[model samples]
Target: MSHIEIFDSRYARLKAVDWDFTDASQDSLASIHPYPARFIPDIPRELISGLGCDKGAVILDPFCGSGTTLLEAQRAGFESVGIDLNPIACLISSVKTKELPPEFLPVAHDVYEQAKNTFDGYVDIPTIPNLDHWFKPDVQKALSSLLTHIDEQSDVNLKNALKLALSSIIVRVSNQESDTRYAAIDNNYTANDVLESFLTACNKIHEAKKRNSVNLECSKIFNQDILSVLASDFDKPVGLVITSPPYPNAYEYWLYHKFRMWWLGFDPIQVRTFEIGARPHYQKKNGQTEEDFRKQMSSVFDLLSDVLLSGGHVCFVVGRSVIKGKIVDNAELIRNVAENHKMVLVANIEREIAATKKSFNLKYGKIKTENILIFRKD
Candidate 1:
């Protein structure tokens, strides 16, 4: 026995994997940003470690979200490239991966001092319309002062960290219920003091950086459509691929984060155009059936087949989604597409997951797993 069943084994491993979102406070993981992209990174690193990648090997995540794979790859000593359509995702990933020099803490202190000084000097806070509506004048003023101080800093690393600090406050300062679908300002929620939140995030980053004793220099981020990104010509570099593309009609990631996108200077209106499987877009089209999903995903595999290096492996992490009362077999469709592209099916791991999502329309909420499809270009 090979210790694994070839038939449906791929689906089984992924079905076994669960997303255990921590109950820790909001500031626990990478500030107030989205789920860590480390899910795939951790798996990829485990697969590639024995293959002689000693921090300089190149890896890629074509559908990198929040650059989790890229960040984790960099930490594990692999040069990584990430491509995504969402600008906020790009910004968040870029900012996090930016290596703050050893002296970043001193620089952060200097920035903080400057901010406090500015406030003491009675500098006026710039008005961000909706922000004022939620935060008290004093809280907004302090945050504005800190933001301005960060803008004035010359140290690029500290500047980026300051920006991260700002983003980390989104939930803490909002009035919305914790871990809910909506986050708006309210008087009863945790009175997240802007300055306190900033300081806390700043310290968290510092501690994380300090504890990360390993040095790495292998992360690159790009903002672009994955389909187009994969189609672009490369300079003769071959590397293993790892990624997780969206389902046909499940999550509208861009719309879900529209508020954060707008706050971070992203134009939400424009991003709606390229978001894959956006709920709003699907609704506008009347509906998204299983066949439509199969075709769209097939197109993605077709594109991937073109750029993958000879003998390279592509690991696709995806979840099953329900479409029009049909159990959409995303894994099978992807396998079919991969076979159509002449790639050999290496494995399908079902990750047993846990979660009864409340946002789902009662049918799709009982998600118990996902699939990790492994294919080789041989």
Candidate 2:
């Protein structure tokens, strides 16, 4: 079939599905951590199944927030690679995709019990800026103790899972209202809530891992910016690239997850420096512009062109951005940029954002719809 016919067939299959996923259940490993503006798992699942890739082909999600695409790729029996600048994001993605041994659950419980026993004596709190504003005194001590215990685990996978469980409960145990809201509120979380919440998160994560376990050797995650990625990073040519690059000035992932990173011993400052589409990056003075975003995307396309196999596809799910009271068509911008890098836009499908899933601030205006742009390497 001609490329046009191939595009039409794929587009039809994609357009038939309910992209909204309003009633869909998101209670899987994808929900193990709270992330800003996470696209539903169905997006990647559908793309992986519908995009006509061979089984075991490598799938890439350069902006894999919490391993949504990586997990879906593994479910569909494919090798996957995920990259993100945020260390916490990398940690969550790695933990979610890695296979846990049969002994993981027992080890996890023992770790929890030991943490509780050693809680009172633990005191290795790292200095975090404005920590008092976000975490209460008692909460800080509780978290510090949990971290000390998590750090003592010798098994890499088990330690990472424990740390993730701890990270998952940080926001809930702090003054932060929710994942989307950065402002502090009068939350009643106490020191007593830390270990209980951690255990609950750990149990849920273990169950989620059991439900969707895949071969650990098939998946890889990188903790760095997409712009810095080289073709040499992948062992094989990627057959499909699925990602949702951050919207311009819509979400500051670094700011919202700074405490979690600090708790996990990662430098949030590093993430802030490299984070693309961050609110701080678009400030009026010494700030990046839409042109800069395009340039960055152009580089991503160029990398995709280099790494993707001939005739491979790249699907980008992006939302419109309201800048200076004008709706910026990010899809078109991506289309134009991708085309310049030897990629051809095949389909542009729009899906309405579910009201409950709209997580950005009202000041930027509501992003009602997201555009799924599919492009093929020529």
Candidate 3:
């Protein structure tokens, strides 16, 4: 049967399953860090198993936020690659997919003790912009000391794990209201609070390590823009792609994670400048528009066409966006772009966003439902 016929046969079955995943447990390794609008693990898990792709086929996620697709692919025994421009997102993804050594917990305990004992008089705080505004004096000192101890570790994997643990707790212990909100509030954080939160985060990582038993080495994550990647960059051909591109003016990931990136020695400004569909990108005079968004997605589809093997599949989980008081059908826009690149739209399934899963505030854009568009490369 032709690919279109095959897709038509499976369309109803795909739509029959509940895509909301309301009671699904998202408290796995994905919970190690806080990321806005992350794809529930079930989405990728079902796709990887249900897509009927070859067992040896490699999966690719171009807009890999926190590596949910890569982790799911790894769990399903498929080699996967994830690409993102956010440094903190890259770090979180790398830590999630990379297996921690058996000695990680013991070593981390020592590091935590050292950070706690040496935090009183430590003086190596990095020059963060508006440090005083976000972090209290005592909290800043404690975090600096913990970072110093984390940096002293010789093992790259262990060090990165520790760094991620610290990064996970940075927002909670700071003046920032929460991970989703950028506003500052009066938070009475202490040095001991910082130390305890770090330790708690480390313990969670240890527990997550014990729970997940997968070929983590099979997943590779890159901290770079998707536009910069080419088909030749992969050693093998890509057979499947699953990703969720950001919505226009929905949320500012860079703005919310700037403090964590700053603590981890990354420049958030660069991420903000290049981040597609960011609020700032649209607010500026003569800034980006719907046409620009289409052009960018066209380039992405072009890249996917070049990289995907013949008959490979791509699934895009996208939502509608409001621009200039008009709603834009992002799913249809992407479908049009893919058709131009010789991709056949197989199915379009709509799913409601769970009440608890709504990440953005209503003032920006209310995304009640999202479309899951599946296409096959011809």
Task: For residue 215, give model 3's deviation from the true position in Å.
Answer: 2.9
Model 2 lDDT, full chain set: 0.80
Model 2: worst 10 consecutive residues (lDDT sum): 1-10
Off by over 4 Å in 1: 1-41, 50-57, 120-134, 154-156, 183-185, 188-192, 230-236, 285-299, 354-364
Give the alpha carbon lDDT tens digit for every residue of 342-376 in model 3. Answer: 89888877777677764233346677777778898
Displacement of the residue 41 alpha carbon in candidate 3, Å: 1.6
Q: What lDDT score goes with residue 37 in model 2?
A: 62
Summed backbone clashes in each candidate are: 22, 0, 0
Is candidate 1 or 2 superior in lDDT? 2
RMSD of 3: 3.1
Number of the top-ranking candidate, with TM-score as the measure? 3
Q: How far is 59's C-alpha from truth in model 3 (Å)? A: 0.7
List model 2 lDDT by residue over 1-378, tens digit each: 001122556467665666666665565776788776665787888888888665546999999988888888878878889999998888888888887766766776776677678767747778988899989988888888878777887888888888888899998998988876778898888777887898889888888888877864446788988999998988877999999999887778898788888878789898888899887887667677778889999999878988888889999988777655567788889989998887887787777666675423324657677777899886
Residue 358 shift from truth in candidate 2, angstroms: 5.0
Q: For model 1, what is the alpha-carbon lDDT of residue 8?
A: 32
Pairs that collide, model 3: none
